[model samples]
Target: MKRFIGFIKKEFYHIFRDKRSLFILFGMPIVQVMLFGFAITNEINNVDIAILDHSKDANTKQIIDKISASKYFSIKDFLDNERDIETAFKKGEIKAVLNFEKDFSKKLMTENQATVQILTDATDPNTANTISNYTSSILSSYQELLNKDISIPYQIGVQTRMFYNPELKSVFMFVPGVMTIILMLVSAMMTSISITREKELGTMEILLVSPLKPFQVIVGKVVPYILLSVINAIVIILLSIFVFSMPVEGNLFLLGAETILFIMNALSLGILISTVSASQQTAMMVSLMGLMLPVILLSGFIFPISSMPFPLQVISNIIPARWFIIILKGIMLKGVGLVYLWKETLILVGMTLFFIALSVKKYKIRLE
Candidate 1:
């Protein structure tokens, strides 16, 4: 019984000494809880919306002031004409637009009715619908206020126009997000163990003794994953198209190119993780803990980035899945071409090169 107690004490000592174990036990849970708490919110804050006021009257100004005063939306643009609305949406910063019809005050005062169109970018249908509902609620409250003691009820008609996804189908958003997650899984999680597996099996030393260059070694290790990832990407796209009835409106070649770029970026990151990790389990833990959460939470997969806190929004720029999701959505839903997507494409390319260079540098150090 004494020896068993000693053994138990020894186990505790070992666990306490191992920082990684301690982190896994305590740190990870706290971090995950905090991340989920902050990032999983459905309520939007400081969402950028545009205003197109044709009347510019007292009622229009009051309604605009009420909307702008709210915490949910920030007025990003004051449009001159309807043509600029499409241009604003294409720029991607403007998520919603409030277009007040002509003679808003006149109509509301004389006819007891007025119309305001709520145009929303519905790439993520949930957000668009939520924005429309919130705006309508605000208008409804205003109508009630106007008719509080009056004999005739003042009516505010809200017309919602959902751009990119008129039907507000949930699948339209999920397909691109699922595609990003799957590709990241296939490319990063699998290859993250490649070098660690070699190190575990005692073949890493043999590879060091071999004449093959680090670049060749890394490339050789990741080639199969790259191919498999490409295949996986194609399958997801096909499934999205045939099964989910998702549209691929942009150039097929451009989409394929972007997909390949993202795959390479993920694979390179895996190689980097494998290079840094001492064991396959460590590699996987790092991959899962480090990559998965950021991909799911920070990448705008389920939540709108515009709604997240400023710091999380800034941090999300480093998440590869975010850019890839944007590219996929642009190509599939918006039918945008490289002209509009050049920035995201360049970012992925830069990330791929950065990871590969870092992994290669680490891999070369193994020889010395």
Candidate 2:
């Protein structure tokens, strides 16, 4: 027990003595939370739009007034002709063009129906879809106001319920994804580099030649990283809960267990990397280029896997972070238990075993 305590103390000394590691241990979670919460968001406001109101009547004017009053869009240009719409869009002056049919008021009163065409640049499909929805909602509200003055025989309304995110805030999705990425970066990349550093410095040989076994040396090197990763996870969860107002609806114990499982998987990957790499630089480069990039790009962190190219989509299936993120969202946002997330949890366990086996094989080959 005393020896273990001494070992833990030594680990703390090593962590505190290295300024870079110390900074990374404490700084990364805060920076990641701020970046994901404020910067990366799907909710857009003040998008510029162009109006081409051909009707120039009371109905068109009223609709335009309503649109302008809303905060979602800012009317930047008023097009005189159809050609102006194309020119303005080409010049990137506006994201959408609102076109009102000629004699809109006359048609609505006499024909009891009129059509308004909303033309949006589909270059960014998500933004385009959001703008269309906002415009439609404004139109619907205006139609509802008009309907209140008259009596209708039958009325049908569709009710919508957003399951996980009632407010549809993008941060709800981003929080868990960002947390997973930070854990991967810190636990896997840092451990790999630190272990390889001892090998590069000839200290690993000294430890191996001493009374300590190969497994003990590796365990000693990784123990600090595991503890640090747990702290980092706690920090990230706290930030998501308090700072971002994100909910953790599942059992806290389950969340902690899954986090530890992912950390173990990441640490095993680090051990595998350390076995393969001879120098700290090689380990860092491999961790960043080989693991980090795939985890970020292919793990459905920012881009949806369903939307990726066929080959990339297939490749994404193997990224551990992808499954972990799905598990996290299920537990954190949807309030699901282990029954729903067992498949993902099992995949992470399988990956950890694979990494451990590979590292052991490689380490044995090195000894031979």
Per-residue error for 78 in candidate 2, Å, reads 3.9
Residue 149, candidate 1: Cα error in Å is 24
- For model 1, the stretches where C-alpha displacement exceeds 4 angstroms are 1-156, 364-368
Tell me the spans in candidate 2 whose CA falls farther than 4 Å from its real position: 1-8, 77-87, 90-93, 144-157, 306-314, 364-368
Local distance difference test, per candidate?
Answer: 0.82, 0.87
Per-residue lDDT, model 2, residue 236, is 90
Candidate 1 scores a C-alpha RMSD against the true structure in Å of 15.5
**What does candidate 1's lDDT look like per residue over 1-368, in tens digits?**
45344434544454457576445434443343334334544557789999999999999999999999988899998999999999999999989999999999999889978999999999989789999988998998887788779775576656879989886666677778777876786578777775687788887788677765677667776766676677677767776688667899999999999999999999999999988888989999999899988998999989899999999999999999999999999999999999999999999999999999899888744633
Q: Evaluate model 2: give its lDDT.
A: 0.87
What is the lDDT for 199 in model 1? 84
| Residue 331's lDDT in candidate 2 | 86
